[model samples]
Target: MMLFEKKSPYKQLLNLFLLSSFVLRIVLLFHPITTTSFSWAEIIKIFLTGFLTDFFVFITASSLIWLYLLFLSESKYTKPWGYIIFGGFLSLLIYVACFNTILNEYGGVLPEIGIGFVALKTTFFGLMLFLPKYRKHIRIALFSIAIFIITLIIIQNSISEFFFWNEFGVRYNFIAVDYLVYTNEVIKNIMESYPIIPLFIGVGIITAFFTYKIVKKSMPFLEKLPSFQEKIKSTVGYIALFALATFLVPVLAKQETSTNVFTNELQANGLYRFFLAFRNSELDYNKFYKTLPDNEAFTLLNQQLEIESNATSTQIIKGRTTEIKKNVVLITIESLSADFMKMYGNELNVTPFLDSLATKSTVFSNLYAVGNRTIRGLEAVTLCLPPSPGESIVKRKDNKNKFSTGSVFKEKGYSVKYLYGGDAYFDNMEDFFGGNGYDIVDKKTFKPEEITFDNVWGVCDEDMAKKAIQTMNAEAKTGKPFFNHWMTVSNHRPFTYPAGKIDIPNDAKSREGGVKYTDYALKQFFKMAQKQAWYNHTVFVIIADHCASSAGKTELPMDKYRIPAMIFEPGKEASINPILMSQIDIMPTLLGRLGFNYKSKFYGQDVYHPSYKPRAFIATYQDLGFIRNNILTILSPKQKVKQFDLSLQPSKLPVAFQLYYDEKPKNTIDPTLVNQTIGFYQTTATLLKNKRYQKK
Candidate 1:
C-alpha cells in the first residue's frame, strides 16, 4: 500500500495551480475586449491556439518549481519553507491574474499565461528565504525582490497602456520592440508623461500585503519529506514530461490566421508578440509577404509615375525653380494634429497663432502623414519615400549618405542644418542627418545660460526659437542661403513652457495647454524673425511631424493621419489647396516652389507640376495605404488587399464607407485606383528591399 503513497501534497498543489492557470486563461479569452465580434468557429480556434501558448508557459514555470521540489523535498527544512515559498508564488499568480483581468476590462490585452512566467521569475528569489542558513538575510532579500517585481510590472503596464491608447490595443510588435533600443529616451519620456514613482509605490504596498498574508497561511502546512529515491524518480519524470510538452506545444498551436488584423492581434499573447518582434524585426518583401514579379511591378510603377523608358528605379528629376537661393526654414512641430487647429473646424483655438498664420501662408488642408512615429515622419520628408515595413530608415543601420532632402539642399550650395530642441542622438537622427551632409545643432550645442526652461524632453520651445534665430542670423551674415530643419519639442507630453508665454498657465499641464504654448512659441519665433533682415527673404515651411493620436477602428484612420502643412512667403498671396498630399510630397513640392533645378531621386511628386495627379500615401507599420480618387486601398502581408470607398465624407461619416477585399466587386470599386495602390506599394517595397532608393 505504501509503494506509491498517493501523490505528494506538493505535487497535488502543483496540479491545482496549473489547472487554475488554464481555467483563468480560458475565461479571459472568452471575455475578450475587442471592437470586432468573433464567430463560434473563430472563437474555438482562438481558444485552442491560445491554450497551447498558455500550456507552454505553464510547463516552463512548473518545471522550475518541480526541479526545486524534487531536489530539496527530502531536506528536513524543505517542507515548512517550501510550502511558504509556494504560497507566496500562488499569491503573486493571483495578483497577476487580477491585474490582467482589470487591464482587459479597460480595453487592453495581455498574455493569458505570460504573467506566470513573470511570477515564476519572482518566485526563484523567494528560494533564498527558504534556506535556514540565510535566515538573517531573508527580510532584505524578500523586500528587494518584491520591490523589483512591483517596479517592473508598473513600468511594463505603463508602456502597455500608452501603446493601447495610441495603437488601438495592438501588442508589442517589431516596431514597439525597436523603440526599446532607445531605453534612456524612452524612460525619460515615460517619467515626464507619468507619475511613475508614486504609482509603483502604491502597487508595491498592495502586492506586498497579499504576499505576506499567503506566506503566513502556508506555514501551518509543514510536513515531513518522502524518501530520496522517490524524489529522484519524480524529478526525472517531470523533466521528461516538460521536454515533451515544450516540443509539442508550438507544433499543435497553428499560427493564427490574419483574416482581420485586430482579430489576429486579439488572439495573440503580448509576451509572445514581444518574442516575435525580436525574431522578425526586418521582413523580406519577396519572401514573407506578397509581391508581384519585379519586371511587372516596375512596369506598373513606371506607368503610374509617368517615367521615361530609360528612367531607372531611382530616377532623378530635374527641378524647375527660379528662386533657388532663398533662405529656407522647415519647422517640424511635435504632435501638432490638424484637428487641434481652428482652420480644421476646432473651436478650442488650441493653435490660434497657427490659425492666423494659415491665412497668410499656402496651406494644404488634405495632407496626411506617412506613419505614426516621429522617425517615420522624418523619413517621409527627408527621404521622400513611402514607409517601408518594420523600422524607419532613419533608425536602421544603413541609413547614411542617402539621396535625402538634406543632400539636395547641400548640392544647392546652401548651409544645411538639423536643429532639434533635444539630443539629436535620439532615434539615430544625428547619424542620418550627419551622414546626409546636415550639420547637427541640438541641446548639446546650447549653453547652460541659454536654456531658460527645460524638461525631460528638452529645452522649452521659446528657447529653441531664440537659438534658431541666433544661428540663422549668423548664417545670414555669410551671404549664403541657409536651410534649417528645426524640430520643436514643447508640444510633447509634460509640456512645460516659460510662465506668461501663453494664455494657458504653465501649471495647467495638459495636452491643450501644450498645443497653446507651441502656438505661442511660433508667434514669438515669427516676431523675432520679423525683426531680422533675413526674415523677408526666408520661405518658412511649417508641418507636423505626425498627429498626436494614432488610434482608431481601422489600422489607417484617415482623420488621425491628417496633419497641417504650409509654406509661408512674405509677399505671395495665401491660398488653400484641398488636393490630397502626403508627408513625402513636402520635399519635392518645396523644391518646386523654390524653383531649384537639380537632379534628384525622390518618390514624392511636385504637387504644382502640370502633370501631377493628387494622391496620398499613408501607413501603419505593416499596412500600406493609398488614398486617391475618393478611394482607400490597403495592402498587408500574406497577399492581402483591402479597399474602401471614401467618396461619402470619410472623416465625417466613416460608418458609411463600403469595404472590399481582393478584387473590387463589379462597378463598386475603381479598377484604376486598385492598380495605382498595388503599383506604388509593391514597387516601393521592391526598391527598398533591393537598396535601390539611390542610384546604383
Candidate 2:
C-alpha cells in the first residue's frame, strides 16, 4: 500500500463531504449551547434546523473551500476540487429553498437583505478553506454579493419591527426580528436575560476553520480519480446519515412540545384569528375556555361568528349606559379557588377574612377559573377570551391589538390604574396593559422603602394593596370614578408571607402557609380600604387569577377550574347566586350589575341575571369541559366527550364513558341546542385564526 492507495478521486470527494459536515457539526458543538438550555427534544430540533441550514452551508462552503485550497495546494490541478465544489453548491441551494418554503407556508416574507447575509456567511466559510484558482475569486465575490443582499433585506424589514418592540416593548410569535432584538440585548440586560446565542455563533466560526484544514490535507489528485460505481459506493454512508437527520427533526420538536402543560397548535401559528374574534365579535378571552385552532378549525368555527359580532356592534352603537354608577375596583386574587376557601363550602376555614367578606357581599358560588396560568387569568378577566392554550397573549402577535376594556373605559374617561406585586414584564403583562391604555405600577416603580419582596416575582400583596388604596384615595380627591385593577402575588409559588404574623401548622406545606398569610393580608387590605373615601362609592369585583394546590392534592381535573368570584357593594346587603359561571363571565356580570347596557363578547353569561342559566366552562392544561345545569362534558383528544352529573350531591361520573353518546346539552339530545354549542366552540376557534381582535 503506497502513501495514497490508487489515489481515487471518489475517495477524495467522500473525504471532502465528510470533512465539511464534521466541520459544521464541530463548530456547532463548540458554539455555546443556546443560553436557553436544550432539552433532549430541543437538541434534536437543533440537529434538524442545523441539518437543513448546514446542508446548503456545507455545499457552498465546501466548494469555496476546495477552490481556495486548490490554488493554495499548488499540486491540485489534479485535486479536482471543482467536482466537490460543484456538488456542495447544488446541495446548498436545495436546502435554502426547502427552508424558505416552510416559512412561506405561514406567510413569512424574508427581506432580500436577510437572504444576502445567509449567502455571505456561506462565502466566509468557503474563503477560509483551501481552494483552487480559476473559480475561487468569482465564487467568493458572488457569495459575498448574495450575503450582502440577504442582510440588507433582513435589516430593512426588521427596523420597523425593532422599533415597535424596543420603543413600545411589543412582542409577537414568529416575527423573527424579535430573536435579533433579544440577541442584541442578551449582552445589555445582565441579570434579566439569556446568554447562549452569542456563544453558539462564536463557536460555529471556529469549527468551520478546522473542517477546511481537514478537507485540504485529505484530497486525492484527478489522475487517481475513481470510477462512477466507486463514487456511488463511497457516498452511500453520507446519504443515509443525511436522510436519518431529515426524519428526526420534527419528531423531536413535537416531543418537546408535549412537555408543556397545555397543547394548542394555534400557538405555533399566531393567535391572530382569535384576537379578531375578540375585537370584531362577541367572544371574551377570559370568558372563553378552550384551545383555539389556527387555520382550518378557525374557518369552521367562525361560521356563526357574525351573530356575536352583531351583538358586539349593537352594544357599541348603543354606547355607554347612562346610570348613577359606582367606581370600579377589580381584584385578581393570586392562586385562589372556591375549593381552597372556607366560604365556598371547603372543609377548612382557610379564608376566614374572605369568608366574612363573602357573607356581606354578593358571592358567586360557582365561578370557575378558565386557564391554569396567571397570564391566562389576566387575559380572561381583562380581554375575555378562552385561554390561548400553550401561548400567552402577552408574548403572542395579538399583544399589540387593543382589547376593548381599557379602550372602552378610557374612551368613557374612567381613569385606569393597574397595580401588581410582581414584574409586569414577567408575562409581558406590563407592555400588554400599557398597550391597552392602563397606567401600570409594578416592582420597578416602587420606592426602596416601599419594596419588600418574597422573591423575584414581585412585591408582597400587603404593599401592593396598600399602594392601590393610596392611589384610590388620591383619585377619590378628584371626584372622578376610576377603574382600578389590583393583581396580588404573595400566594404564588415559593410562597412567603410577612414574618411572625401568623403561625401555620408545621405539617402544612409552605404554600398552604402562604395562603394563610394572604388571607391575613386581605383582612388588613380591607381594613385599610374601609377607611378610604372611595370605599363606599366603589363596586369591588374580586376573583382568583388561578388556584393553589399543596403537593398532595392540588392536582387538577376539570373541577380545578372552579374558583371564587364575589361582587361587593359596601353599604349593600349579602346575596347568594348559585348559578355556575366562569372567569370569562366576570366582566359582563360586573358591567351588567353596574347597569351598563352593553353586551359583552363573553362565552359566560351573567350569574346575577335571572334569565341567564348557569353553564360552567372548565379547563385543565390538556382538557376542556362544559358543565351546565349539573351535567359536565369533558373534551380531550384522547377521549372526546365525557359526561358527569353534578346534580347528584357529589358529582357522579361514569367509569367508561363515550362523548357523543345519548347525552345531550339539555339531556334530551336537542339537535338545535347541540348545534348551538358546537357552533360556539367552532366559532371561537375561527376567531383565533382570524385574529379578529386586531381589526378593531
Candidate 3:
C-alpha cells in the first residue's frame, strides 16, 4: 500500500523531520535549566512560534534536496548539462566543510573533518551521478546513510543543547558560533567532559533503528519515480514554499522579542539560531540598537566624563618622571569568580593561596567583568573601552594598531609581551596583541621538555607560570622595565592538572579542582618570582578574564559577572578597596598608582582620580549594560532600553549577600543614566568602527 497520496514519496520522511524536531523542543522546554515560570498561554505561544520556526528551518534546509532529487529524474539526469547539477552539489559540500577552517593558521581551526574528508564525499557523489543502473541502489544507500546521520545529529544536538543550557542558560548564540572557529579546543573539551564513546554508541544504535525503519518505508516508494509532470509540479510547489520561508523567517524569528530571554530562546530552533548567529553575529549598535545623534551622544559622554572628574579630588603623588620605570606583571586567569575564594564567601576554600595573597594585596572588592568571554576580558583590559556590541574588538577584523594599555607601556620605554599557555592565534589574539605593540609568547614558544602536563586547552598553569618568569627574567636582564601579560588556562573546563599539587586529585575533573590547582600554581609562581632579580621591582595584577558561569533568570545577571582583581606589590600592606570597577578600569588604576601618564584613549578611569566616578560597563553580545548609582541600565537591539534597580540581597550573613544582587525592574528609565549609557556604548562602537579609538 502507498504510504502517501502525494507525488513525493519522501513525504513521510519530512513528517518525521518535523515531528522529531517538535519532540526535541518539548524536551528542552521542560529541561531543568529552562525556566518553569511561564504561564499556560505563554507556553502555547512558545509552541506555536516554535512550530513556525521549525517549518521555516526545514524548508530552507530541504530546498537543496528538492533541487537535487528533481534534477535526478531520468529526463533531467541524462541531459547534456546534467554535470552542472553534480558540480553544484560538490561545490556546496566543499564550502560547508571548509567554512569552519578559514582561520586555521591564525588561531582559527581547520576542523578534524576537513578538506580531505569533503573530497572523499565528492568522489562518492560523482559515482552516484554518473552511473544510471547503480543509481537506484546508490540512492537507497545514500538515503540510509543520510537518514542515519541526520538522526544522530539532531539527537546529539539535543544532548549538546541540554549541556549548553545547563552551563550558560540559553540556546546557541555567538559563543556557539565562536566555537566553530576553534573546533579543536571545543571538540576536545567536550570529549574530556563527557563519556563520548558510550554516548555515541547509544546514539548510533538509536540512529540505526530509525534509519532502518525510515528507509524501509521511504526509499522503496522512490523506486517508482514520479512522472516528469508530477516531479515539476512538486518541485515548483516546494520552491515557492522555500521562497516564502526565506522571506518570512527573518521577519518572524526576531531573537529578542520577549522580555524574558529564555522565553525568546524556547520559541526558536537551535540549528536555525546557530546559522542565524553565524550570519548576524555582530549587531551594529546604531542600526540594531538605540542611539542618539552622534554629536549629542559624544557631548553627553564628554559631559559625564568632565562632570564625574570635576566631582572628585585631583591631588595625587605626582612624580611619574622616573617611577614609571617599574616593571609590571599582569595575570588574567580564566573563569575566576569572586565566590570561588575564601576572601569572598566561598565556604569551599578552593583558593586558599589567593585568599592568603589577598591579605597582602590591594583587593578590588567590587570588580565585575565586562562580558562573559575570554576575548571580551582581553579587549576590556587591553583596549579599556566599553564592550562593543556583537564581537569583541580582539576578535574583530581590522583590529590592529590600537592605543591599548600595551601601547602605554611601549611609549614608556618598557618591553611589553602577551604570554599565553595556548596558541595565540586562537580568537585572533596574536593579531590583536601583536598589532598593538606587544610581543607574542604562546604555546609555540615552549620546548617539549618544558611542558610537564597538558590538555586540549593548552599547557597547565604551572608550566605557563614558569615560562612567564623566564620571559620576564630575560627582559629584566636587559635592564628595562617589562610589562608581561600572562593569560592562564587551568581554571577552564576539563580542568585537569598535574596530580598531588593540590589536595584535589586530577581525575575528579571538577571546577573546584581547577580553581584549587590554579591557586596552588599561583603560590608556586610567586615563590619562584620572589627569588628572581625582577621580584622587588615588579607589581602583580591578578584578575579574571570572566567568571566560569554567567547564567541566571534575569537578562543580564549582575552577580555572575562579579570577579576578583587584586594589585600585589612586593612588601606592600594589603587593603580592601570597595569601589565598583570593571575589567577595563584595572589598567588605568594600576597606571595611576604607578604615576605614569600618557596620551589617553581609554574609557576606564582610576577610582583614585579626583574626577573618577564609580561605574561599571557589562554586556553580552547584544545587551549593553551600564551599572552606576545602584541602577543597571541596558541598551539592547531593536533600540530597546531597560533599567533595573540593583541592591545587595538582604541576608543575615553579610559576606554571602555582598557578592550578589537583587534586580528590580524600574517603571521608568532615568533620562540622565540612559543618555550616559547610550553615550558610552555608542561612542565605543562608533570609535572602533571608524578606527578612531586611538591615543592622539
The digit string of per-residue lDDT tens for model 1 on 520-549 reads 989999999999999989999999999887
Candidate rank order under lDDT: 3, 1, 2
Query: Per-candidate RMSD vs. true structure?
Result: 9.5, 13.2, 4.8
Q: Candidate 1 regions off by >4 Å? A: 1-169, 213-266, 308-311, 320-323, 647-675
The per-prediction tally of clashing pairs is: 3, 67, 5
The models' CA-based lDDT, in order, is: 0.71, 0.53, 0.80
lDDT of 2 by residue, 158-274 (tens): 333232222212212222223343453323332222233674454344434433433343344322344445445534644554466455433432432332221111111112212
* lDDT score, candidate 2, position 591: 74
The estimated TM-scores of all candidates read: 0.78, 0.56, 0.89
Best by TM-score: 3
Q: Candidate 2 at 21: error in angstroms?
A: 30
Give me the candidate number with maximum lDDT. 3
Q: How well does candidate 1 match the true structure in TM-score terms? A: 0.78
Q: What's the true lDDT of residue 611 in model 3?
A: 69
In model 2, what is the error at residue 141, expressed in angstroms?
A: 40
